[model samples]
Target: MLEIGLTMKKLKLKESTCAICLTAMKAGQGHAIFTAECSHSFHFHCITSNVKHGNQICPVCRAKWKEIPFQNPASDISHGRQRINAVGWPRDDTWMTVLRRLPPARLDTNRHIPSLYHAQEPPIFDDDETLDQQHVIAERDVSIIDGVGDPNSVGTIEIKTYPEVSAVSRSASHDNFTVLIHLQAPVTSGRHSGSSNNAELPQMSQNSRASVDLVTVLDVSGSMAGTKLALLKRAMGFVIQNLGPSDRLSVIAFSSTARRLFPLRRMTEAGRQEALQAVNSLISNGGTNIAEGLRKSAKVIVDRKWKNSVASIILLSDGQDTYTVTSPNGTHPRADYKSLLPISIHQNRGTGCQIPVHSFGFGTDHDAASMHSISEISGGTFSFIEAEGVIQDAFAQCIGGLLSVVVQELQVKVECVHRNLHIGSIKAGSYRTSITGNARMGTVDVGDLYAEEERDFLVTINIPVDRSIDQMPLLKVGCVYREPITKDAVTLEGASQVWIQRPEIIGAQVVSMEVDRQRSRIHAAEAMAEARVAAENGDLARAVSVLESCYKSLSETASAQTGDRLCVALCAELKEMQERMANRQVYETSGRAYVLSGLSSHSWQRATARGDSTDSTSLVQAYQTPSMVDMVTRSQTMLLGNPSSHRKLRQALSFPAARPQPR
Candidate 1:
């Protein structure tokens, strides 16, 4: 898949050559040639026509275009970039805007929490200049939200969250009401893949544009010579151009060494142009030094301008740390780039601040193993862009998703008021946790809550009721999070109860289908994890048996339910997936694919699931891989942080170049 042996060279454009339009260059029509480090020539219209296509790799030599007119060390001072993509301190004072503080909340006895706000502005940006307003940073950080529809309005997925459910049973059993969550996306009726099954995907509603502080860390090394570097530039373009005026951005490029392209600045017209120029001037050479780039990223991220913004770092790397240097003084031991992993995470995890580093591994040459671990430990998401073109899509999706965040740093606490009840499990967002300390308390760290993104979490509780026929409170849920717009702390609480019945009656209530679906997903994920472990240990038989048996059992259960078409197909897919495990095909990909897919697949096993329909409602476009089908959609919005790594099926799963969906 890798086209190698090409060197960066000079371009001598002839009238008959074109890289993009594939036609001859015309006189006076102009032509564009990447003359610095590449010899690709094309029609000017054909070449410059596309900015963020992620296809900037030279067609003739497969060389990626280096940003034009690379800045010298001294000359970069004027551009506010310390080195490559990193930002330097600005000379102007326009960026010193003030942020206003919120007033007291009005009391309302009817609602326990009283009033929060009409709309919270992003605390990072400034609406006024010079002096700090009622506070620091921005005066009034108002966000503009257009009409957005729920993904459920058209999606086949059925996500149901039960605050409380009936616990009445004829038999005298433990009566406990646990929070039930379900994410069901039916697929059978939409098996006609050629047609647009827009209904199969959820359209996110509640479009709100908020400010963000994003620092892009790029790997412009020899390994990233071709399409990798090209796509990264294209993706960076997507992120920079679509940034809100209040957003703060910086760029960092690293190969043998690291360089900051620009200093952290607001996304005004000048700032955007400067940032794009930096992106355009980048070139691939030397070797990878990821830690160096990350270190520079930390420098740009700590800026006061982005203090209240939804801040994060985007890292694009194709290889491991292939280059390290010894200390010049000879008094100190040489440093390993791998050792910088913890240091990089610690940089953002200082005090009360955290800068989630969304990392992307480019291709076969990429160091995905380390990159993904960094993302997980740092509480940031990980992604891989297969080869080329998908880079821009990944960026668009990631930025778009970050922009659509409804709340950040979600901390959920679950407590039980009822006696003799033990919490079995608690699911929140994409992660599920079990209560450890006491049956009374459990906590879940939900990273981000997206607009119209319904994450149905289930809390399974085991109740041992001897014989109390009275009704009582069973469960309590508490949530603490920063307001999406204002970045102020907010707490929300809710409680649910259940009734116990006589133990010796007939006809016990059937558990909700949604609950069963979620439970099934958990079991499937366990199987996948186990299978992965087995395969890694060279126990091919065990791995195959694990997946195959789980698939068979799932199929039997699904067959009992209506609409087995999708289920049957999934079972077949599982069979194929099981074979993949036996042959060692998909081990390197995401370990949580089963969990993410189960969120959708098991929903069909539940009743009240939607039948396929035709309703196209556009909403927030966040790149998420639920299954192979949804995975293919990754190409369109490819927002950089994709964790899965499918090697052989790259073309089938990869997305096209991306564009921003306006909020």
Candidate 2:
């Protein structure tokens, strides 16, 4: 039977002495639970107060507890405690032995804990002070200042971690973890345990298998004038040239509007060159309209009837929407990028097409809030191109990240396997699975599998594979995308092959969840910031309206995924933040007031048409806003005195007549 722990084992506490009582736990009688990678364990309850959200790490070792996976029992022979907490097969003797030993709760608490795992070496600690005490003091002293709401804050989203084949499982037990297994493998020459008997296990195939479909959407907007636009073009060129035969590509460009430069096409040499030509033709004009742009690109995939491929849309934009078209009833504005939902798109699934949209933020002004929402809704990736020159590399990385589905409806049947291991949620592109049934040592079908161009399984199992018993249980995995006979409807079938080994825990779920949480929180903060900006410009109604919408989105997202306490906190924090911004009166020097006042008074003339009285007169009515006029004069004053202020002032200037028409 598979055995899961009854309680969460606490990592060793960091303080040399307890903060409250100033004494360590009683010796032998109290257990000090150490994390798997580091020789640090807390006195069960010492670190709870410091937890901000989710799992906390050992203060001294910096070893996070959640990354450690559950291990087997036989390996824990030396640990006198009846309960065995097996880490992965010993990489080193010291690692195995040290983890196997139980620390004297009282004395070991005061001693320096060495890094005993081969994977992570002990950290150098020169100071004599207890690390935990110092850490607590430092953390507490850190001012709980308001989070930054700068433009960069709105557009920066980072992928904190990438998925790896082998990693720790992060599932809490469902009905407690326990398991039993019985395998039926063809007998071969191998030692059966320690007895003088032979055990034969089924020899399974081990061939590398993979397929991917990637769609790229780019922003060709006026704001991307210099380095930003050039970098993006170079990046697209690199992606198209290096695409493998097994991969497929589609290209779309958005200016003030969205256009499909190249429809979803195979990555053939000619097709790649044609797509490259399309990419080369892209130029900056017009404004940003990411919502409509994404909608149109997604439509291309639907029109072409592409399905079951590792579908993804990569969007690169540097600003917010200028104009948008929505439903006639105004229930859902097509132009509203922030609240665009998958269900809205799915309902209008004009054709049978489903593709994930991954987004990449280019500059500091890129609308990360909108891009992040699109990515999360589509169950795709999102990242930022931090430096200026690395655009091509960024695009290449996006292309390489797509998943390729080989087998359609894959289902694995393990004949005899039982464990208390709780199966976490499974994600396979469009195909997903949920764990069900009794925890018994018998047959079980997990889910379907997908393949990439170069075949690899993106799988995550709760337990390690080495814990196999009874000649390694047969793993039958298969898929059914379409009926062979009818060739119309989706169907399923048994796999002709068996997985010789356990699927690795790629940790894609955890990564996706974590990234989503961080991005959403940042997005909520940004929307609030933008609303405040509008408020500062004397647009109180717009500020109130936008903040209300942002609050709702944040609240709903946090509710959908219960673990995100930060988003929930931020949601409440935003209302307070916005109120403060609203309370601050917009002075005459504010950019909007200054600009508006000059335009109304006809004090500022259009540089391009200084003598065109007719044009100047017409523009004054549209451009004049008391607030904007005041701000522009102040900005001009600053620009005249300071070179640095020129760029900032330039950003505030707008010439409607000089703007080019959208292509």
Candidate 3:
């Protein structure tokens, strides 16, 4: 056994060249290498590029790859050793004899092999590299809003309007058109705008930013007994550590019932220690009572005496709700869980301020539908933690956005200015919308705006043809919100009108790529919603079909506008969604939750830390806050008290690389 192990180690050391790159794979080199199940090693970028281009087979062996390799090749050898130990050596065979008898594996070098460096495919590598550079530039742009004018200025949110086309046909009796409203919050130097390498919490002074009042509602049910509960604790610790002294935190645990483990208090050093202690005391038992948990969390938020603070709730659960009522006959489960959505009612009883309730489905068994609905109703994003250990990354992403909020109680209004123009409809994802003033004006209640966060609203307008006017203004858009620093109301309406030229010829009207991208996103989100409903109803085939149709539609758009990053990303997402839906095992285990949460994220225009899909153009990768990306990259090393063996296993399984850039 020792001789065989030594021989294998020597062989691994000797195999220094990557099959795809045909270059030395050495430590401390710039590029990372991945080993496939067939033991064929290639550069990580090379394999990823191959997979992204719709090739799922190994480059050298043509073997179908089940999953992308994201770990160090050394781990495979370690796993091999473990398997060898599990199936103990034959008693009759000696280790030296077996080592001598084993023959060296042969590589069929005569076979033609495709290389990324091939002359015919030289553009592929360059295009991928360009895409990666574009992603970095996009992230930098998102991190720093340059045209804000004043660096010290706070509470500045910019809004831009884009029309589908610049011209409308005068021959038609009525012209229907789409308009997009894009809103962005300014980034300030006082806040953490870019990514960080260390997982340590940032230090803040007293007057840096708005104080956050965060309530964590956790599920401590029997289903979350062992590993789930432990990860939750570690995640909570990371959360607590991230908050500053100006922030206030409250902890609530639920199973058959709910109780507050810690009251809302400023996170001073002492307060943080107490919160950590409370988290450590959690024990899993009883059935899941998600409603009770939310109810308690709402009560805590309502009872808080603090004023002028940024407040929200983070609810995490691992199972379906066991909501029941006691009657004279017997205890009975509730007929519907929708009636238990208490977020709106609690908001009314409080200061009338909107409180976002970000909910996370911990594992596969959790009710994703209920969680998504809960978040949508409360103007929050729903995240699906399909894997056990990634709960920390999800929580970190949610909290990172929360802590960087720049504006509150944001409201956007679109009013038809022309007499002939009328509002058809507005699509603003999960945000609440209302039509007022005889359907001429539409209002969207966008609860909060994070620094550097972008949101889009698509509005359809009905225009009556009029040859008398060469150009006409159709709609007037405006924004009203409260600045977090001064708690003062600010209204913006500059350059918010949409106008179209009434051309007699009606020649080819130029389309706005930005507007078209957003339109495709809204359509894709609707399709995802349909697929999610079908899957939940046990019609996997119908769900798969719906996603396939959507993918086809988006793919056409993507192919036409390959330069549009958002459009291409949406197409990739739809393709991934359809592939997951087509597989029965994947859909049931993690796909259902993934699809539901992804739909919610899309509809709500929020980013999540769900799957580790290495697609660089993915919305999650593009929109994720820098702090979120950093924390997710370093989650495995964030030690919370766990058995060394368990930690080692987690470290081995955890992919240390950040989501790969395009290259």
Candidate 4:
């Protein structure tokens, strides 16, 4: 339920406040306020903006509004976003909006199965029924393990029982594994419901169908060559073979420009074969222009039909891009290949397409960092391959990622039993819990839990529940799903029983991992830069130090391939710099090359101009490491293109009047 009222002044909220930190808003601080049918008030800013662009709901109250009513640009300019929420509509286009139109919550209409109960009884066992055939209900059981001191306890599965709907979701491995999940509520009455226990609910209730649109962007760059292209083709065949008939797939291959290998097509054996053959025909040629590929892929997914699906792109590449706007001398101007893809992805997702992207870096030359960012921006995955042989597996992994997105942009709203009760923040991911003691206490297990065949995904929710014991005990869960295209929202309500409270311990494991990964990448990039600078300044020791630092940091990264590549690249660059440092010491004397040290190039030039031949031998005698002649030859390899600098040092050795110009 939603209510909209023109506010002459400020709108006040009830017990509910900001989702980031549940607290009362201070005076003069502005926030969008929402009032639900239950008279629950929530700060509008807390729910709308705190969430992504497409999601619009009162996070505290679980009320949903529409978006089309507030599409007027003038109204937006005058009243701002506050008006959009007040009107019960999406303020802007986003993936969250698309998920909102999905099916609403529905209960199984079938007969009531026995609610298993064991107040204080021995272990209960039910093995006659299979997962597919058995109807789950609220129950408790304890198992006694032979030779063990204590019995192992298992909690009951209280799933709203429904008739099994046959569903065949495409598996990433191209295996023939398919299962149906509940999708719609069947009509049932008390007496009739009890009698018709076999009536099953639709797999994937209409509310959770999760409309999706997927686009495949394949790299046809020449570097992909024979084997890489063949593997990619085979992997693609597997992907098509595994998809559910209801799902859609599109393929786009790119070299310098994008070309559709197959327009948006439904999953069919014949269709899959045609697409596979098209992929095989895709000969690798020309340069890699990723921007063009993305634009074309976006155009296909933006269609109204694909909007029913979550828009997505799968990029396969084997090397870095070559042609693009570049400033050779600008600070960090090597073209942000990784940053560019995310920008494109975000823009498309904002336009009624919650399109996530997954990347398969097919070979060592590809930019792995860029692939990862592209995946993150679109809410997808990234994988690195060492050889063409792994292409099929890589493709399968990408398919798995797509299959895992059972739900998109799922937001949870929680209400506490007490007004003062504060709910701690919840991270995104699937959670598992056990109802204990006739009362229920909720303990969330956060992380991806694979469904029988679906891919894994990360999910987070902000619930209005208390973390500490000094507040309300009961916890209520509510949620809203934003449609990827329509910008509509479907609200849902759920709850857990109350029992003896047990503290749940969660560590900062993911946070630490992210930090470490970031630090290592930054360190490696900087160390390489520093080494180059040190060599330019003729500081061999500093150059060596920078390389060593980079080498150590790379070793600490999780992936050996990433670390090894950085180590190898930096070591080679450092070696060149070290050689230059040695050669810069050569000076001229008596028209013959002479080994020298300690004297700055400037000093050497000044001394030679004054005909001070004595300084040449003196400089040489100062260091016993190597002769000036020997250093000159060694440095030639290091400073091959730095002719001006090389000439100056050699001139200084003989005439003491030459100095190389700075590069």
lDDT of 3 by residue, 1-663 (tens): 422221212123443654433456664454444665545565554454344334444443333344542222233333333312111211110111221223323333553323212224221111100112332343344335543553435646877788877887776655458888887776644654433533343422224345687889999998886556756876887788777766778788899988776567666555665566577667789998888888777777665555335888999988878764334565443324357755442333123466778889876778776777677667677787766656766787787777777777888988998887778888987777888888899988786777667788888887786878888888888888876655567888743788878878787666776676777777788998898888878898898888788777876773235545565666667777877777677887668777877777777677764653443112244366443454454444342212121122111111111221111
Off by over 4 Å in 1: 1-41, 44-178, 181-208, 303-306, 323-339, 342-352, 427-437, 470-472, 495-504, 558-560, 564-663
User: Whole-model lDDT for model 2 versus the true structure?
Assistant: 0.38
lDDT of 2 by residue, 1-663 (tens): 323222334344434332211234343545443333333333333333223112233333222233322233343336543421131111111111111222321223433433222223113211111122332332233223222531111111110111221133322211211121111111111111222211121111111112345667888889986556645654665566445444567677788877666445554444554555566556689988887788766665554543323455788876666566546785533344535544433312212244556566664556544555465455444454434433444454344333212222223322213233333333222222334554221122212122111111222334434533322222233332421111223332333222222333323432233334434544554565566468657777787678678777777763325745555545544454444344434321122222122221121111110111112111121112222232223222221112222222212223121211111
Better of 1 and 2 by lDDT: 1
User: Candidate 4's error at 199, in angstroms?
Assistant: 32
Q: Best to worst by lDDT, what's the order?
A: 3, 1, 2, 4
Report each candidate's C-alpha RMSD, comma-separated, in the order given.
16.2, 30.9, 17.8, 34.0
Q: Each model's TM-score?
A: 0.62, 0.35, 0.70, 0.39
| Model 2, residue 486: C-alpha shift (Å) | 18
Q: Which candidate wins on lDDT?
A: 3
Global lDDT of each candidate: 0.48, 0.38, 0.63, 0.38
- Per residue, candidate 4 scores C-alpha lDDT tens digits across 1-663 of 323331222444333333222345443465444443323343544333334433333222223333311222233335344423332333332111221332322323452323122122112211111111111110011112221332221111111111111121211111211111111111111101111211221122212223234678888899976556645654665566545444567777888766765556545444444444455456789988766677667667654332343457888777665554346664321345455553546523213444656666665566544554455455454554443443444454344434433333443333444343333332222123333322222233211111111111111112233445432233454444442212344455552212122234323322222223323433444554465456546665676677666666566565333433323433433343334344343111111111011111111111101111322111211111111222222222111112222212212223111111111
Predictions ranked by TM-score, top down? 3, 1, 4, 2
Clashing residue pairs in all predictions, respectively, total 45, 64, 0, 64
Candidate 3 overall lDDT versus native? 0.63
Considering summed lDDT, which 10 consecutive residues are worst modelled in model 1? Answer: 607-616
Which runs in model 3 stand beyond 4 Å of their true positions? 1-152, 171-174, 192-206, 323-335, 341-351, 558-560, 583-585, 612-619, 630-663
